[model samples]
Target chain A: MARSSNGESVFSRVVRILEAFGPERPVLGVAELSRRTGLSLATTSRLVSELVEHGWLERGPDRRLTVGMRLWEVASRASPALGLREAAMPVLEDVHAVVGHHTQLSVLEGREVLFVERLSAPGAVINVTRVAGRLPVNASSSGLVLLAHAPAAVQEEVLAGPLESYTPHTPTGPGKLRALLAEVRRTGVAVCPGFIDERATGVAVPIRLDGRVVAAVSVIVPNDGGAHAQIPLLQAAARGIARAMRPGQE
Target chain B: MARSSNGESVFSRVVRILEAFGPERPVLGVAELSRRTGLSLATTSRLVSELVEHGWLERGPDRRLTVGMRLWEVASRASPALGLREAAMPVLEDVHAVVGHHTQLSVLEGREVLFVERLSAPGAVINVTRVAGRLPVNASSSGLVLLAHAPAAVQEEVLAGPLESYTPHTPTGPGKLRALLAEVRRTGVAVCPGFIDERATGVAVPIRLDGRVVAAVSVIVPNDGGAHAQIPLLQAAARGIARAMRPGQE
Candidate 1:
């Protein structure tokens, strides 16, 4: 019931301010935050000061501000994704060690795939996915696997395409994508050669918990014939994670 | 500033509500939340509803409330500790593989040690650390390493001790802890045997960024002679993480 002058709740304005920060831009000035949130200067200043006082945001010696460690602690300790990420980590490490490339775990959130965790070595192939980054639900192999298992309405919405293309190999046509989704559901895996980037290949498999598709586990390697060898590895890892999540099953 | 009837800012009250959730207690009913936050029932109900609407909190099917995935995503994407954790993860994985136990990275926050990341194999030691969990400044090896290098004021405050001991090996006396602090600073590592739990030993070394001690890398193994051999491995991993943090360093 507490509304700001613009008829929005205080909680809504606070979220807008927090959303202005990202992996690419971790620190910002008060004026920039105000401009991004479309909030008045006085309101933004007061909010930022209070946030800093409670360790939800931190101030630098240069007077710029960044999200605080306490906020991360509070969010991470109780995140719904924490159990999945923890269960998948050792298996992901095994896959990374044997396969020697980029490995990741993601879940379908809204209309995009939100990456929950990723592992890569110093000399691995290029990967654009950060831990909390998001990509279009039809652009990456992990996204495709998730989209294949999405609810009927979500599937139909994507099928009514304005599908964005990332590279030459990306499937932009709704018909082709629909056929690909059917194949993924049939085969229980997704493989895309140079879909997101021309120089790499992506392979992913569904991770099921309680007989429901919950996540996608994937790896990125060079766009060579070697990708086929990794599908079995990915499938095994997904099964292992699912078993870890549901310990009493099987 | 929007102040509640109690003269505290609403932002502060919101943070208090969030801080009520922890690793041990992730979900709670609204009445419990009201009691934990010491806010009136009406205020807590209004705030919780607004937070749930904004996806910062979730109302479970059973009507309990938990932290939401959107909050985790927003906090994780911009956390200051993300860079350090990412840099240390590979090294931590290597250490865990070699040590066959629990490996972790922690930083000094306020007067306590806050673990940012942890890796544990199934049926490892009986360690008590978790990612995003905090421990007293004098209670664990990681905490000791961080406390040894902490600011003078913090060191003095902790040394003026009401130190709570978890086991007989925990150094509760100020004089002995002062000597241990000097030893850690001299040798650049802390080896605490049975300090936290009786069955495990903790070993830690400092991680430096830009020539300043910024974090601690640690491992927990059975409280036996085998843990001594792991010292070199832990020291090497700490050095590797420090180098990764400063890319141009040797």
Candidate 2:
């Protein structure tokens, strides 16, 4: 492993450089990347050039850098999330057709819910979650179901405190969140009305694989008191996804 | 920018290690990685440990290494492919629903067609393309559509090459490929029957953004006479995807 003058490994610096990019700012100039990563301009330039050479970063016509298709290909082709998304996609489409809103698949990553896939109609309700985006564990129905089935340590960690509130309906107190988790576990579903946004209701159910909850399937629909009607649809879709994900199937 | 005694940079070694993992073999032991990457065991071990610490690589309970979710998240969240896939997904779903087979979105990556998104229903046609997988520029309908609209240099490079034939129907000769490209440009579609598989037919259309062909939308259905009937559906879906991708639309 090569080390910089400051004793940071080259890999660490590379990670910092890659982390500087996000959905909101997919492209950046060398100076902007250096400023964002806090690396020296010379070091950033050297690293970016090396990355571009390897096809991990690409320069557009204007010479701004974006994460290369090669990088996405290498990372995505074998990703665990890809496997789950592939298994869930058919059912997700079915749910999207029936729900006519934002239907998504999410998994617990560390302490947050990372949306792996989402299907939405053109004029559906507004959804803050995008593919590969994360939301706090207490602010979305998918997060609630995942949190309910999460291990005790993870549950305790999220329950420790400081839950970020997205809307007035979002559970902020630990006790309220604990009760919500218990309700989700008991009901095998999570329904949060106006949790993330006042205009949408999120309904989610656990997707099990070999009897363990591995992911959540959710629908975000208009919060017009009809969110619960889609609970059975989501649950059935979740089961179909789990069945499709089983080994020896397609 | 740290270089080894052999003058290979750390970034180069990392790329080699990552490239060793693919859709077929997503997990490997340290020894297997070292063997595949041709790196010293000590160097591979040290670098793997560093990568694991940074969440670029993960060790499963069985002590095998897989690309980490953090790495996938970073690569995917800001990927240009993700933007295109998001734009095409709804139309892809509609196509899948109507075709009852594989509907895919692909882009020209280097000299190959790289599938960015695919929607398939259960028991659909036997299609080999997976999301993030690549096919030769002359072996599939999506590839042909993209290659037909690619820059002259790219077209010439592919034209000058030894095109790999998957089936007898595949166009392996430059003259035939040239005719195919001309036909795709003239008719705005590519319909390759049994090019990759004897049981499937691929139909594709170009997707334009700002009057420049940006991607290809394709469907793989059973090799029946009905393949031509799908051309209009595919063209409309392509137009919808292009309109959806327009700036400030969503």
Candidate 3:
């Protein structure tokens, strides 16, 4: 492996370059890439050239760099998340058909919930969560379900403090969050009205594999009084996803 | 970028490591990684450690290496394919619901067709295509549709030679393939019966944006002489996907 004069490895620099692109900024100029990655113009240019040569980054007709399709293929084909998403898709489609809103599958990633799949309709309720997006563990229903089933160490760390509130109804206090988590575990579901958006209610349930919670399946629907009515459907869908994800099951 | 002793950059080696994992083999031991990547054990070990540290690769409980969630997130969130998949998903769902078979969205990558999204029912006909999977340009309906609209240079290259046949009915001869491509262009659809599998028929239509073919939306159903009936539905769905993908639409 090669290292720069600043002691950063080439792999590290490449990671920074790749991370610079996101849902909000899918393409960037070389100068913007250099600024975003905090690398010198020459180094950024050289790295970008190498990346483009390997098809990990693409230079469009306008010469702006975007994450390449080859990179997406390589990352996605063998991703551990792919298996989970595959298992959840059918169930999610069913749920989305019934709910006619936003149905999502998410997993615990570090201290946040990373959404791996989401199905939305044309006139679906407002949903801030997009595929591959993340939200604080204490700010969404899926997060609460995952957090409730998370390891003790993870729960303690999240409960330590700094729980950012997205809406006035979001549970930010450690004591209230702890109670909410307990309720989630006891009830086997998390239903939060106005957790992230005032007009939406999030309902989620744990998806277990081999008796260990691996992910959460949730739906974002209008914050009407009918939110709880979808709980059974979500739980059933979660169970179906778990069954489909089990080993040796096609 | 740093170069190894043999002048190979770290980025190139990392690409090899990532590419070594695929749908058939998603997990590998360190020794297997060294063997698959053709990198020395010491180099592979050090690189794997660095990759694990950055969460590009994860070490499972059994010490096997798999592509990490962070890598998938970074590669997916800004992927150019993500926008296409998002636009095609709802239409694909509709097609899948009506067809009750395998509905897919694919794009041309070099001389191959890469499936980016697919929806399948449990009892559907046998279809080999998977999400993020690839097939030769002349071996599938989607490939033929994309190849029909591909640049003339690419078409000539593919028609030049080495057209691998998946089944006896697959178009292998240059003259036949050229005629088929012409038919696809003229009809605005490709119907391949027994192309990839004897029991399945593939029907595809081009999805265009800015008056240029961008992708192929297809469905695989039983090869029961009813494949052509799906042409209109697929064309409508393709048009809907293109409209959804247009800039500033939603």
Instruction: Evaluate candidate 2 and give its CAPRI docking class based on DockQ.
Output: high
- Across B157-227, the per-residue lDDT of candidate 1 in tens digits comes to 99896898999989989999999999999998898889989899999999877778899999998998667
Ranked candidates (TM-score, high to low):
3, 2, 1
Tens-digit lDDT track for model 3 on B3-121? 88888988888998989999899999989999999999999998999999999999999999999999999989999788899988889999999999999999998789999998988
Q: Order of candidates by lDDT, top first? A: 3, 2, 1
Index of the highest-TM-score prediction: 3
The local lDDT score (0 to 100) that residue B148 gets in candidate 1 is 94
DockQ of 2: 0.85
Task: Tell me the TM-score of model 1.
Answer: 0.95
lDDT at residue A146 of model 3 (Cα atoms): 99
Query: Please, what are the lDDT tens digits per residue for candidate 3 over residues A1-250?
Result: 5788888999999999999999999999999999999999999999999999988899999999999988899999999888899888888999999889999999999999999999989888899999999999998999999999999999999999599888999999999999999999999999999999999999999999989999999999999978999999998898899999987775
Cα lDDT tens digits for candidate 2, B177-246: 9999999999999999999999999999999999899999999989986899999999999999999899
Clashing pairs in 1: none
Locate the minimum summed-lDDT window of 10 residues in model 2 chain B.
B117-126
| Error of model 3, residue A189, in angstroms | 0.5
lDDT of each: 0.88, 0.93, 0.93
DockQ of 3: 0.86
